[model samples]
Target: MRITENLIFSTVLQLLEERPVSKITVTDIVRRCQINRNTFYYHFAGMEDLVQHLLQAKTKEFLGLKRRFRRPVTFLFYMMLVASKYKTVVLNLYHSDMRGALEATIESICHHYTHLYMASLQKMNLSDTDRELLIRYWKTIASGIFLDWLKHDMEYDMPHAIKRICFLMAGNKDLSSFDQLKN
Candidate 1:
C-alpha cells in the first residue's frame, strides 16, 4: 500500500479513460505518476501486473458490500456508489475485450448475494438444488438488472426498487413476507 502505488494505479485508471489497455505502457503510468522507471518497477513489474493488482483491489472492494445489513437497498446504494466511482471504466470494460474484468466483478457480486440468499434458504430448509436454483436464478436476473440499471440510470425509490428485485426472485412465494421489514 505504498502511496506511490496508489498514485500509479489511479494514474493508470485515468489514462485508460483515453486509450485502450493494450496501448497503455509502464512509461505512461510513471509519467502520469511523476515517478521513475525504477520506482514503477519497485511497486509493480509492469502494466499487466499492475492491472491485475488494480482489478483485484477493485473487485475486492465491490465484494465487500456483503456486510451486515437488514435490507437489499443498501446493496443497491453500494452499486450506485460503484457506478459513480468507475463509470467510464465500467462502460469500457462492459463492452471491451476486457470481458474478464467485468465478469470478475459480476461473479463477486453474485457470490455475496448468493451468500445472503443461501442463509435465508437455510432458515426455510431448502434443498441443495433449491438453494442453488435460487442463487442461479437471482444471479442471472440481478446481473442483467444491474447492467441495465447502470447503463440506463434507472430511477426508483430505494425501498421500492429493492421490493421489485425481491419480487424478481420470489419463486412463487409471496414476497409480501418481507414487506414488514423495518425501513
Candidate 2:
C-alpha cells in the first residue's frame, strides 16, 4: 500500500474515538477518505486488520524512547505518556471482547526488549553468565513495567518513575559496552 494507508489508518483510529471499530465498516472508511471501497480493501482486509497494522506501526513509534541510564532520565514518564496517548485505543483493544490483541501488543513489546538484550550481549565481550544475567534482568524489568502500566490506572509517568526505579534495576555490570545501549 502507499503511504496514504498510514494516513487512512490514522483517520480510522481518530474515527474510532467517535465509534467502535466493529460498527465502522469499510464503506465508512471509504466515505471518510472520499475514496472507493477497493482502496480500503487494498490497504487492509477489514477493520480488524487495520487495527493490527496501526497498533504495530504505533508500537514501533512508541518503543523508540530513550531511557536514561547514564544520567537520571524519566524513562517511565515518557513511556507512560506514550502509552496514555493511545489510552482509548489500548483500553478498547484489551476490553473489546474480540481477541487478545491488547495482550499481544504488550507481550510483543516485552519480547522485543529480550531480543535487544540478547543482541547487545552478542556485541559485548562479557562472559556468558553476565550476559544472561542482564537478559534475565531486562525481561523481569520489562514485565514489571508492562504490568505496572496496566494497573495503577496507568497514570504514572513511566520515564519519570524510571529515574527513581532505574536504581532498582541497576547492577554492578561491566559498562565496557555502554555504547550498545547508548546507540
Candidate 3:
C-alpha cells in the first residue's frame, strides 16, 4: 500500500516537472503510474489530496535532518538546498493554482526550524511572549526570502546570499538590544 502511494507521489512530481499542477489530473497520474483509478482513489481522494500528502511528506523528510546546524541561517540554507534539488517542480507549483500548498510547506519548515533554533539558545532567557514573537519574526524572514527567490525565478546563488545574511547578522554587536526595548 505504501509502495503504491510512493509511486503516485513520484508520478505527480515527475508530471509537475513537465507541466503545471492545474494541467495535470487524476487520469494523467494513474495513467503514468500504470495504476487503475480505483487504486489511485484508494490512496488519495483527488489531486489536491495527493499534492497535500506529497508536501507533508516532504516536510517530514526535511524535519528528519539529523545533522545539527550551528545557526538557524545555516539550517535555512540547507532547506533551500533541498528545495533547489526540485527546481522545476517547485517553480511549476509556485506558478500553479496549488501555490498555497507549497507556501504552507515552506512556512511549516521555517516555523519548526525557527522554534528549534530558539530552544537551543537557552542562555537568552527570553519570556514566552518574546520567544513566540522572535520565532514568528525569524520564520517570516526565512519564508519571505525563499518566496522572493521563487518570485525571481531562482536565478541567483542562494548560498552566497545566505552567507551575506549570516555575515550581516553576526556583525550586529547589540543582539540583546531587543531585551532592552521592553524595559
TM-score of each: 0.67, 0.64, 0.88
**How would you encode candidate 2's per-residue C-alpha lDDT over 47-150 as one tens digit per residue?**
88887888788778766753333211223344456667777665555556533676677656655656554664554687878766766655566657766667
Model 1, 4-86: lDDT tens digits are 87798789889778777777788888887788999889888776677778778777776665565444455556666666667
Q: How much lDDT does each candidate structure score?
A: 0.66, 0.63, 0.84
Model 3: lDDT equals 0.84
Q: Can you write out model 3's per-residue Cα lDDT over 24-51, one digit (the tens) per residue?
A: 9999998999999999999889988999
The lDDT-based order of candidates, best leading, equals 3, 1, 2
In terms of lDDT, the best-performing candidate is 3
Query: Which residue pairs of candidate 3 clash?
Result: none
Q: For residue 85, give model 2's deviation from the true position in Å.
A: 1.9
For model 1, state the Cα shift of residue 23 in Å: 4.4
Worst 10 residues of 3 by lDDT: 174-183
Better model by lDDT, 2 or 3?
3
Model 1 clashing residue pairs (backbone): none
Alpha-carbon runs more than 4 Å astray in model 1: 17-23, 42-45, 69-77, 148-183
In model 3, the Cα lDDT at residue 177 comes to 50
Write down the TM-score for model 2: 0.64
